[model samples]
Target: MTLTRPETAATPPETDAAPPPRPEYPRPDRDRSERWVNLNGRWDFEADGHEGPITVPFAWESEASGVHRTWLERGVYRRTVTAPADWAGSRVVLSFGAVHHRAVVRVDGALVGEHVGGYESFEFDVTEALTPGVSAELEVSVTAPADKRAIPHGKQRSIPRDDYDGVSFTPTSGIWQTVWLEARGRTYARSVALRGDSLTGIDIAVDLAGDAPEGAEVTATVLGTGETAALTADGSGHATGRIELAEPLLWSPERPHLYRVEVRTGDDRVVAATGLRHFETRGEELHLNGERIYLRGVLDQGYWPDTGLTAPDAASLLRELELARGLGYNLVRKHLKFEEPLWLHEADRTGMLVWAEPAAPSRFSPEAAAAFEAQLPAMVERDGNHPSIVIWGLYNEEWGLDWDIPGSAARAEAAVHAYERLRELDDTRPIVENSGWSHVRTDLVDWHYYEPKLAVWKDFVARLAAGERDDFPVRLAPDFVVDKSLYGSAEVPRSGIPIVNSEYGEGFTSLERAWHLRWETQELRRHDRYAGYVYTEFADVEHEAAGLLDTWRRPKDWGGARPADVNADTVLVLDLVPLAAGADIEPPTGPLALDVHVSHHGRDSVSGAVHAAWLPAGTPVGVPVPKPEVSSGPVTAEPFRLSSAATITVPPPSGPARLLLWLADESGRVLARSFLDAAEVEPPNRRGARPGEFEDAPAPGHAWQPIAFDDS
Candidate 1:
């Protein structure tokens, strides 16, 4: 596509000095020294006849970009830079971490190259476009159409309406990732793929670039350990070898150990970090390094209030991972967006497992399918080296499939094709064909279910775990039936596959939301057939309020309850089903019996005592609430084994109350806690009173007599 220079071309700033030190290197997996420059400070920006200065890495719609506005059809950025004086003969390359939709690069008005995918990194050899130590004008033109059906725009609303827009959020336009320049040797490593296996060691593959000759010597040295592996390049410029460790330190969420390696060939050297670990499914269970693991995951949208998709700073990326880990989550499902490499790097460093997927197109078409498929190879190639990523997800909730995969054969085929395409790209990780539902093919049988009624949710969880039902009710289109199963027919049986509640949670209030979090997590843990679960979200985004934290990343008031309490590795699962939120019923007149079970995922069996207590409903909100009143003597915990651990008789309270239950080890350390709210109910005769009649006095026919009740 040819383009004429706009009259509002952004002019260069009046400065000859070098830019400030850039944020941490954009690509942590492949690091090169002193030979690169970060172009992230400022650039003259123009779009839709308006000209101004915009930040380099932030999207135009974000507050951090200084050009915070609505969506734009097109945007142009211009800057001038001079190659470092020290680099005399090496080839200079202009690299863009990523650009939205489509981007065209130019040096001094001469077109250098172009890239279409927005999430993949690309570069151009700019040596021919400039001379050493000379100033060169760099220009990038970007076009981001608002039609999401034609492109992969995950959760980015195209035309926001006044009503609910589901999970859609603000749209991001123009350059949203880092831009930089690097110098490479005549024969440098183009790409490096490292596959570290605890059983087989680390497999290394290097693809050479530029004028690479045959028989080039390639060496990979594991830093600190002094272990090295060597390989020779063939006529095709590809070298492959394996590095075996004498005693491998396997990587796990409990003990995350990483191995830093530096690979060299001639003058080209890149440093990468990987851990020796293996993730697989062994008959209805997820195994990490040969040990079964229960995935405690939270859905992370990778967005910020002010920065949009681009994190405000490097520290923000690490902070989010740390926050999730602190909440007792070992895995984060990076929903939709192909998150920045820096975020993935943090996951690797902090020992958090990641389920990564690319953005999905809103509609199904040949062009849309191709656009979606185009991102898979690059996604796997760019992120396959990270051992933290255990699963590759595609097309969440049947998006881009017209939201009708069960009835349409063509859409089903498309979903299957996408699954096969991703598997072909990288077979090392488990691939979820359609993450939420309509699983034509997948390594795990996962579903997304949301129900606020405690009784219904409880029954469904029990039936699904006991293998009584394989599908949940889901409605894709207006006329479609809601009873259809997302699972494929006889072709794909659900037996022997790990079942997971990938997405499930619903509540409008913070207290209600926390109630759901505690109950839902408890239900999942109570079933041994279930492998894992991912809460709806980590933090609240624009319109979605079902998050553990608010938009500002502050923990919501969970009414004296902490998420870590229910998210612990060992949890006490109670059989008492509480009433739904805001629903009141007559309080029990006799002793309340509850069956308690321990769900422990630790390395060894745990022996703990089940404790029960009651707290006045009017207790101060922020005070510590759990104080045990009755303890069931030490009992050996067994998975899914229910026993009547507690029975307490108390006088019905005059007002609402809370029943608190907890599991404590021999040392008295509280491992998990759960609470049941007993809402206040009116007297038998007062139930017939009009809503307003009881405000100031008793019903018209009843006397205003006070009944005595225990407060404790």
Candidate 2:
């Protein structure tokens, strides 16, 4: 069922309707702790012959840079930087994190380098191209067709916020990433690839810049144990060998193991670490190594309000990955765009699983498919070595592309063909023919069930097992719904394949982008009949606000139950804006202080009444306001007033005192929850660590532990 591949779309035009190319920061300083070339700030800027302010790393359209909202059709940028005299005999490397579509680099009127691909790093060796010591003029010319549908671009919608002007879909141009100079010796290590296999403990490959030195002793030093393993290679600058590891420290969401690796060849040595593990799919579940590995993953578009497709820097990558890990997510499903290689590298180091997908082929013509096939091998070959990548998604929801299918038996035939093609190209991983389960063509049957309805999902499962839902998970023409509880717009009357929730949650953000429509409002048009609810999203992309957290990374108002969009993209209360000197405060007269108190609220279920428990830490021997009346129950009065005493204060304690409260209904039921709010009676007189502990708050993170409400 393999359909002939399509032709590549014609190269983008030379029209004067785009911005000039820019540099991207795909690589960073090996040390990574200090000293950085802030490639993201203040570059000479312009657009379509219009004078613009210098905005280095940020896109022309983002608010972070005070640049105008006006985006560019095409333009050039010029910046001046003098090379360090010590770099006399070094090769000058111009690196770019990403520039939307195409780019060309110019230095002192000499064409230095050019790059393609909006989601990969491209660099050029410019040792003999630039001046030394004196400030050399660096000019970058960029041309990008902002909103051409013909291109394989995705989700770059131009929905206006306060005003207009900026990148139409986020502008592109010079140095979108970090650009710096790297001094290479006669023989230097270019990059390293660490792969851990089930049979083999781990395999290490090194990409070198110059010729491999003869009789070079390549030694790999494992951190922690200080165990050094040595190996030899023929000549292509690659050294491969497996270590004698008894039980490899596997990387999982619950346990992330990072190993430091040092490769020494000749006199040059490179040090780095990688997380080791294996990802595969069994009969009904995805496996990490040999165990069932549930992917509490977030759908990350990887778009930044300020940086567009490119993250601000590698540190930004660390922040997102670590935050996701803290929230209990083991996987990050990169939707649409293929990330820069460094992002994959970061995933390798940070113990996060990755499901990489190329931007869908927009125009579903034979030519487009062929072009996609041509480009796909490169994408897989270059990024495939990463162990974090578990699956390859062939197509997403929007594209209506199909393959070898005809007549009544055409259901998943086309998808099966597409899935097999990807498998043929690379058999190491599973291929999801259609991401949203639009076509159940591959090993994993993917379904997106937003706003879950348990009955609908169960019935759908029944149908797949028995063939046809019959009267179970019902179907409707314009849409369908078996259970009124589910949320969806398209309903499939019959179902097949192993259920995988592709899209479930929606209406993510408090910010603008895409607004959330309630399940009832959409009339349960086409919801899922699946096994799980993957939920719409975990964080807000630039315009797509339906996220577990707002753009600021703060959790949304979910009645404080938590785990409502809990994994990944969650905001920590510790990282919140405090009410007092903490929030947008003017300089203080003295030390910052706050009245700290804790109060618990709930029902005394057995008593059918309210009860309160509170502990205070900062209450001095008060002269007045003694015996603060306190009550714990549903706020009986307006403004959610607790039936407690005058004021609740913490008792003397070294740590934050417990303020537990209980509320009950007339029938002894919990009656839901009651009102209880704590306030700062007075600020701590002195600064630094407080004497007592605090009333425990929910742990800030993205992990999901299903809450159990015992009716037992």
Candidate 3:
């Protein structure tokens, strides 16, 4: 094929200052070599009669790419590289970490290959077209259409919509990850699946790419354990084996122990890590390595302001993982986006569990069906080896499924087919057919509840357990789940799957978030049938200001409560805030009388000193309050006991002030703390009545009518 170019010649990028060094090779499973070359520098780009140098691997819609325009049209990339003389006998492989939508490649005026799917990796063997020790021209034509329904587009949009769109960020196109080239033998290990067996050891499955000689065998060696297994390849070029270890150190959030395994086939070898662990659901609870555990998780969207879908650097990924771990979160629900392998590798090393999902197209059609069906299985196969990923989320909130159409068994069938395909691909982890609603043939009954009132939330869960469902209006489609599940169809009974509040808490104040989280978390803990919970998000995105941290990753203080005070364990609770974090006290000015509630969630008795004080907001670091009082005298306490109506009288101060309460142990270490702002803050969700306003629970069969399409 002849090389085609636009009439205008491309110019230098907008800025001459050096961009940060390109991120290191992002594919964790692929083997590394000194013979590889990084093609991530400036590349000539052209689109819509405009031409300029654009940064490779950074999408055109981002500032880091030196071109922040999203025209939703075709763009071209061109570069030149000289082939290495030492790579004469090996195959010259050109690999793309990921290219958005579709791409056509040409090398030295000859068409080499074409790849579709924006979120997957692809490679081409270009050795036959390369001249030894000579430079070869390379070009790539990419197309990312504005029609969001046809492709697997995550939370991005050509035109902003309501709620998650304008509040969310912009969409990205073109190359959004690293691009590189390397030389490999004719026959290589294409992929490997590693599963841990507690009693035996590790199970190894290998898939090969090129031709292998007769009698060729694949071997797996455990690095530190000195265990090895070898198996001969069958006619299909696949092999399986098992390695036994003398002692096993199972992986958990508390202690993340990973065992490295090296797989060799023919002249090729690849190294990766895995921990001996399995995640499954039993009766009403989720178990990790055969022990029941609650998932204290935060939602991560994996988007950045400057780089679009890419992180600024390797350390940027590490910082987010470290921050989540420091805040006592053991798992992160990677919302919507299928993250790069580098991020998943870090999660494995840091011992963080992940709930991975495929990015959904905006609308449903035959094209959407084909696109999703093709990509979902590939996503599972590509990410199956990572030990951190425990759950495969098939769909989310019915984005692409046409549930509104009457008697649309096709929509339901498509969802079930995807779930079955995933199970066939990897049977190690549980599958969530649909995340929020319209769950069909799923292993878990996951839903969302965002009512601001704690008492209402308690009632909702109780109603669900009693076979009476309540309205989940937030983020639900008008015609959602009408006849999709057993709740509507008589053919299927209430699947009785384990329940989890997958998403909640989008807009709440510091104090409200603290109190609401405490109540909701304790409620789940009190009920064994509910598996666990995942809060809406970890940090704020664009206009959504409901994160524990702002967009720039700065922590928004939780009234005065620290991380340990709100974590799952500790077992201490207090409620002294006169109103929600940003609400005004009714009196507006005077000596205020505050009645707080306190309770211990532990099972053993304890003794501690309760300290209370009222101080101005801007008091000096070490300066003490003018006059402090003891709310509760030091005394022995019994387990599961409640102390209600504890009052603390505070004289009105000259300026804005706060009341601080702390319960300290014998060593003077604070076990629990709560703070109340004297003045009204900003943007509180104190919408209607507070908790307990509707004092009585609904009668046995009187399930709150679920909001439906026919109703408001």
Candidate 4:
């Protein structure tokens, strides 16, 4: 395969100015690494047209790839690996953690394996094919289409200009992940099904391809909670039994409880975890553990700058889950992508609910559908045991399906018929028809719209959630508000990172991005979205300076990144149970006419303290509109800027008020105003959470009653 990598001819002396990359991610990862060999460090690489030294795995266009800007639509990778010394007599199985789209694998030039899916694990049994003690050279050829339907590619923006702003995304292919060899015993278990049934107890099932051992005793045990069971199985490698738990804990955004499972035979042991709960949609309500559960979810496109699709390490992956949990979000809609098994494991162990999505193909024909069917199960079978995954976002924004599919008057009926198939495939999880679309059969109506983008339409949110279903979270930040107002578009930290943050806060800004928008007329053309300066950013990545943090996960280049503050939309809630940090506000006793004061940061908008009441989620607490006022001073409180800095200060209320103040910006954008001193800041969800266990919940010196769980 003559790969056209022109960059390889420029290698200098071995001791160049560039520092060598840190090869090790972390050694403690005993879960995903045990069954495979580490094929990560270095492999002999050559390009199509140029035969020279190149880094394996990383694409030639990447800095790690050691290649220049020369590009190729197709490429090949070759590496030689010898059988492990310990596996002198074992079966050597070659495994590719991931190979984009189309890859052909040959061992010693003998065509041994071919896999079509870009985002799945593929393996070939080379034990019988390769000679003993012989070094086997494996060659893999990869081809990527301009816009392939079968492959699941994420946000890979191509370069549009020759002059490098360094914001361009490089293309990828070949063995992107670890390509290693493993040894397998006869009749090894391929996959295990672990279920924590609330009613029938725990159901354990194992599936194997090879001949099962006669009288093989299958033992299943739950780690933390004392639950164990054993059953003798026949030669089919089939076994079904139940383990008993004393008291089962329900899994929720507030309390995600996972119990470890140990499955074993004479010599094999596989360990994983599952929770006892159910997630289904009944009528208008999404039911979990046989009760209604509201999912405060954010959309997360799992992408990083330096690493591309792969995270820096598991720490980076956990950061995604932890940041969402910190923001009080209960669910994360894993948008348009299927993450690696380790990601799902983190969600399961950490207790964040995952809405797994398959990459939406731009085009889907009968052949494409067949390809999807073949690959979808592999992803599900590997991830199904996870309790954290509650919903499967099979199709997104008409990726495979189309606009006309949902545009027909029979939209709900067509959707309902299509939904039956997903339900049949995975009975345990819910299916979202399309994110940000309304379907009568949808368990949840996924919607998306930028604040200013939808501000003109007015019915954007209503139309998106406008469905016949009686139950569903009608309005939630409108997929999230893309704040684009040049004056005061804002994306504040809604706790931490949202599971999704499907929408931006307000407007956006960067140095030259302004001119680009001005030329293309994207935000400029529409005279909206303030030219892609959406209100808030997670942290500024590359040239996109809207993020709360920077591209490196360090605080941004400048210091405006606030990773500590928690933000509320309509009301800011604080748990001031006496000793909590910033819990010094004294409660008022008399019938005080609390005035409302609003303000902006730089301009100093509001002046005096205003009196306001406290209102919980379902409670009825009202305060008259402060009409319009603008004042300023050294006083902490200020008058609200409906357009930009919308901060409101409230004094103690008259009655037994639990509600804080309600605020509306000039444009009626509601900002959160919470009155409860927070009880606990961050409660570990590993153990099913107890109500008052948060660090902030029982602060020093204050007598307090626990607030109803606000996690979800």
The best candidate in terms of lDDT: 1
Model 1, span 538-573: residue lDDT tens: 988877777788766777877656677677777777
- What TM-score would every model get versus the actual structure? 0.89, 0.61, 0.81, 0.64
Off by over 4 Å in 3: 1-20, 159-168, 197-199, 213-215, 403-407, 453-455, 465-470, 475-496, 508-528, 561-564, 571-578, 582-712
Deviation in Å, model 4, residue 29 alpha carbon = 10
After the best TM-score superposition of candidate 1, give how far the Cα of residue 410 lies from its true spot, in angstroms.
Answer: 1.8
Clashing pairs in 3: none
Q: What's the lDDT for residue 415 in model 3?
A: 72
lDDT of each: 0.75, 0.47, 0.66, 0.47
Question: Residues 1-712, candidate 3, lDDT per residue (tens digit)?
Answer: 0001112112124344754235477666444554677788688899886699888778888777878887557899998877788777766778887888899999988998999888877788787877657799899899988766656777777443422243346777898888887766667666777888453488887777665633468888988777899977777778888888888788766777777888877666678677788889875567888766667777888776567777656666667888777766778898878888888888887899999988777566777867887787668667777778988887776667744322466776767777888888888888987677666567877776555555566666666656676335442332222323322123324635567777766224655565455555545544445666787667766556556665556677655545444543333343322344433243236766655444443446556666667666633212232334655556444533444335556666665665566566676666555555556555535569679543332111101113312222
Report the poorest 10 consecutive residues by lDDT, candidate 1. 698-707
To one decimal, what is the Cα RMSD in angstroms of model 4 from the true structure? 16.1
Least accurate stretch of 10 residues (summed lDDT) in model 2?
A: 1-10
Better of 3 and 4 by TM-score: 3
Candidate number that wins on lDDT, 3 or 4? 3
lDDT of 2 by residue, 574-605 (tens): 11122221111222233322221112111121
Itemize residue pairs with steric clashes in candidate 1. Answer: none
